[model samples]
Target: METKRFYQQRLDEWVEESRKQAYKGRVAEYIPGLAAAPQHALGIALWGTDGQFFQSGDTDLHFTMQSISKVFSLLLALMDSGEKSVFQKVGMEPTGDDFNSILKLELVDPGKPFNPFINAGAIVIASLIQGDGPDEKSERLLQFIRHLAHDNRLDYNEAVYESERETAHRNRSIAYYLKDNGVLEDDVEETLEVYFRQCSIVVNCKQLAHMALVLASDGVDPVTKQQVIPRRYVQIAKSFMVTCGMYNASGEFAIEVGLPAKSGVSGGILSVVPGKWGIGIIGPALNSKGNSVAGVQLLRHLSQDWDWSIF
Candidate 1:
């Protein structure tokens, strides 16, 4: 790995170059709160397992986790229900369709979700989380995230949560479909509440990087040297991050950046370079596939320049 000074200077220059990509995309507007984000803002934070940190551009800007939350929720579900049970409810394959598409749920027999990273699959994973009800489940998931980020202050953006709940008609339909297919064992509304709240958890780039660091270390907290999550579960989550985390663009990202990553509609991306660094990025402008345009470009630049790709 390069020195911190080297990364800092390159990141400073690269961020500005990447920010130019923002104009080619647009902020997500389906959720009213997300629509209010600054469209051109871009930021990145990288945390190394060796305790080096580098940040540049709009690193202080906060954003919700959105679909990135699905990665953790899937981990939690696996921890709660184990691999066999979780796989029974969701398949291991990625759907080439849009992240929220309901086409496969109807066309596929047995009706299990194609994978846990998509909205329908994540809703089913939310139901699998162990809790007394929606509130407990949401709280448990939140606490788990806080633990990963090592920031107990982490909490949901209530405005975003309410906005998502208000505008989640399609998600509701997906949940109902999953329930009808017997893939979801919990009440549809309650399960959705958990999913919505998880998606709304707010954090800046540095904090997001911290959370990614845990995953990069295979669920160990590098600072504390503690095994916070089981290694097997982390392996499973990272595999999904590779295969389905970028929605329909996973294969392109694999070839381009070659790191396991998860992207959110909020324009946040959590990515990990195995055994080295964990990265977090935020750029409000999104491509058609719902990934951060500037953020992806920035990662590609860094990966190519620094040879960070796992492949």
Candidate 2:
């Protein structure tokens, strides 16, 4: 309980400190919906293996998951298609380019994506989720995320989804390229629909923390003690999160935070301190690498303070 009290006190101090970092970054404006968030806002929630839940600062603010959905979608793809099948469509290494870059597909031999977390790779994985159509796949992915969060009310932000769909010229090009290369399992538009809808799934820090707790426990629900995803698949997802989850800034984050963390362009990050805690953070202002500037700094401070490094 002393540790809990200490965490409470430190979180308040850290949140105030981190909030200042947000002013240095810009809110993502590629999609019209994301540009509407308050730039200086920062929030965080933590769910401990010991059943302690603590939250501070703007924790109730809702935002889309954005690229963070790739983690869960990759897990669902593995569950549906198995590792061999999933790996066949996407490579395991990280691409040093931007998450949506298409140049690597032409230069990187065999033409598969460098990893599942990137946009090109995620689109292929989206096609692998078993469904009769885009709507069904989107529903299945949402249900899986809801099951993890233990909140059936979780759903997509239609306005965001529509905005993403409308402005997805680069994503559309990637899908078409994948289709031309014969990597997509379904129609290009359909697969992109699933990808866009998943990215639009709205979440707050509390729900994100609960969902991340499943990954922290290695696919087991900490509260229910049930295996929600196979251990091996969770291992794969976490590995990807470590190496590629922060987009081009993953190596820097790994060196500083030293935990498996996936960040979204919407300024949301889902981090796992394996067997100890699940953390969720949101700060609408983003750094150049499409990650939350304030949220990333806060994680660095927490990781150093708690000595949570996996390395």
Candidate 3:
């Protein structure tokens, strides 16, 4: 068989294995909505410049963007405020705290939330979206993300939005603290609304993967041939991914996988291979860190098999 045939063959095999692996993990239980997801649900999808995608299992299930939205939220802030201006509000360091933890703001010197990937930092990023209110800001973010993914139909799932709103007391606390610290500009409730809305934007693996693919290709969808975001911005985002994408386990994952990736509580993992490929894996089962369990295994297997280690 030819090389292309062999790659296709392996891709099929991995999808099957991932489905079986999904059952071994447990659905994220801490979040009310997430805990209700089918524990056995599993999906893996891939999108590349070739304009072809291979997906398997329950690939159509809609899930919250959850933490994965932080990636674009950070980029939008950087794009609107410039990197230097954005960093003045949030630090690039990784903290080992739980994603929604506000303890670090007081524990650490300079008291900046650790990296844009964390909840506290992500809230600050939301305030920099350059709009008058939550609705305008969220629409701006939605438009940017839709363009990046080359999908105009993308929109928020109101159920997930309301679900998060009702359950986001912790996130609201973080947002208010950022405001108190002078890191957030928008009203606390309004900023939390935007943050919750961003997290509620639903996407499947194909949409999510293509979103990552745009970043992988330096903010250009090769198929669309449009430069959705500046190449330099993608570089910076990927840099942060390597340094801080995986929450508290970022260092461990970095040492093992060597790729800049982001994972969400919705069992979505957006893994990027800069200039080559972007992978999206969604399996609701989560570990202690709120990362998708089977999703991690799937990406780790793919990265190793494809030799996608970026380090």
Candidate 4:
């Protein structure tokens, strides 16, 4: 096992080597707040189940969770509604389409979302969260995230939330379509509000890494040794992460990096070297399929150098 000193010595060199790939991608612009991010910025943090920690580059830089929030929301939904109820709203299989594509919702029988990591499925999962209204639901989800991250101060980036809410025509359309198809039980706008707020939750790489660490330990907090989430739900979440987390590039990532991971449009990725480390990365530049270009490169390098691939 590599010591913390060894990681600290080499992490910066690895990060800079990976930063060069940022030139090949661009920041997401559909959301005004996200477009303002530095296109070349790259950062990473790693937290080990054995209590080792290492970080490099823009690790302190804060960004919205974007689609990465879907992972936690899915977990919370499973806890609230159980596997049977949650699966009734979203499928376990990946769609291979763009994360926001609604084509399958129209053509697929039952008209349900293919998986929770996608926008449509995430919206459906949001409705499954137990609460009397959107505000309560959003708060409950945020509290769950805070608990997983072990940080009580974590909260929303309201600017990003408003920006997403204003420009989310496609998401709005998908929600309404699901409503018409008998898939959505809550009010369209209310469920969408919860989904938007969850995506807008602000977090740094370190905080994200901590959250991933819980999953790496099978829903246990390494420091406290407490079961933060049920093991079965963590297994379910990790399976989805492997198959559908990186938008349409999940298969490629699974083959190359071989770790369960989730990526967000804000250029954040939460990945796990199961039973070992939880990794968080932020590189605002995105490839055509909406994943962090430099972040993925960095993970590829580390996975190869350290043989971190679970496969």
TM-score on alpha carbons, each prediction: 0.98, 0.99, 0.94, 0.98
Q: What digit string (tens of lDDT, one per residue) describes model 2 on residues 60-165?
A: 9999999999999999999998999998889999998999999999997646898999999999999999999998899999999999999999988999999999
Number of clashes recorded per candidate: 0, 0, 0, 0
Residue 67: error of model 3 in Å?
1.0
lDDT score for residue 44 of model 1: 95
Stretches of candidate 3 exceeding 4 Å from the true structure: 50-52
Estimate the overall C-alpha local distance difference test score of candidate 2.
0.94
Candidate 3, poorest ten consecutive residues by summed lDDT: 48-57
lDDT of 1: 0.94
lDDT of each: 0.94, 0.94, 0.81, 0.94
As a TM-score, model 1 comes out at: 0.98
What lDDT score goes with residue 305 in model 1? Answer: 95
For 4-113, candidate 4 gives per-residue lDDT tens digits of 67877678888998899999999999999899999989999999998888899999899999999999999999999999999988998999999999899988875799
Q: Candidate 3 residues 191-286, lDDT tens each?
A: 888988998887888888888888888988687688878888888888888877888888889878889998888888888887777777778887
lDDT of 4 at 239: 95
